[model samples]
Target: MKEYIDRKEAISAIREYRGYFQDQKSTDMMLLKMEAENILKDLETFDIVPVVHGKWIYTGKEMWRCNNCDNEIAGYDKMPSEYGVNYCDRCGAKMDEVEE
Candidate 1:
């Protein structure tokens, strides 16, 4: 049977693999790179800050919210193309044309 792990377990597994790579002499570079990429993707999904240009940047995935009612619309890519001009469902206020 296949096993499933929660986010915490997944993150822990990634960290453990990284440590193993550091200690082992015969490391698989391609597998290490793939794991690194997976770790980054998981971190982003949890709204964790990621390293950028050698620095940990405090930026999460961009989210949209209704200006008038403070209702959460959706994250950047999930938003509709016409969301900029749409009205808020809760308050009937026009959506903000500009992203913060």
Candidate 2:
């Protein structure tokens, strides 16, 4: 979880997240927006602490781990347009980029 000091930034973050959810075109966004708005509305009353979890779950992206050095690289939404993508970060080992 991350903390924010500014309330406007927090609201903007939630709105941007709402956009991401809306981009998926799922009805779940309606419920999510309700929840987010509720949280924002009560921000001043209940200490305003927010926690985001589930980072431990493995998300399917082209996440790479350098086998030789154990360094991890988060994948971008689109694959790089140039060259083979096995270039390593640490020992310069050409590692496989696994989905998830």
Candidate 3:
């Protein structure tokens, strides 16, 4: 059996081999190159990791709220308004309070 190369050495060799394969597409060269790639892939079996949690954060848009001091509220993404009390922030409350 052939001896296994260490991961770093294997990676470097694979990079070199890929460059050579790209430049020369002969059948015998491709076979050898593919064998080298298979070995590298085997080395990769030890490298996978599962993502646990708390991996990201969002810091984009401002918080949306009800136009009135009403208990209900709406997010900016859901409903957008130009002026005050365009729509019910809570439960789609309408502008019932008329103005002079």
Which portions of model 3 miss their true places by more than 4 Å?
1-9, 17-25, 44-100
lDDT per residue as tens, model 3, 1-100: 5344467677667656655357555777767866877777776334433322111111236344443443443344433343354555345445443323
Off by over 4 Å in 1: 1-62, 78-85, 96-100
Clashes of each: 0, 0, 2
lDDT of 2 by residue, 1-95 (tens): 74546666666777667454566556677678668777887766336543221111123485544445655666544332233544554455544
Off by over 4 Å in 2: 1-4, 18-25, 45-100
Q: Which has the greatest lDDT?
A: 2
For candidate 1, give the lDDT: 0.50
Model 1 lDDT tens row, 1-100? 6333466666566655655457455457447756765865665343433222111111336555654456555555544334353565566654435543
| Residue 23 in candidate 1, Cα distance off native in Å | 99
> What are the lDDT scores of the predictions, listed in order?
0.50, 0.52, 0.48
lDDT of 1 at 35: 76
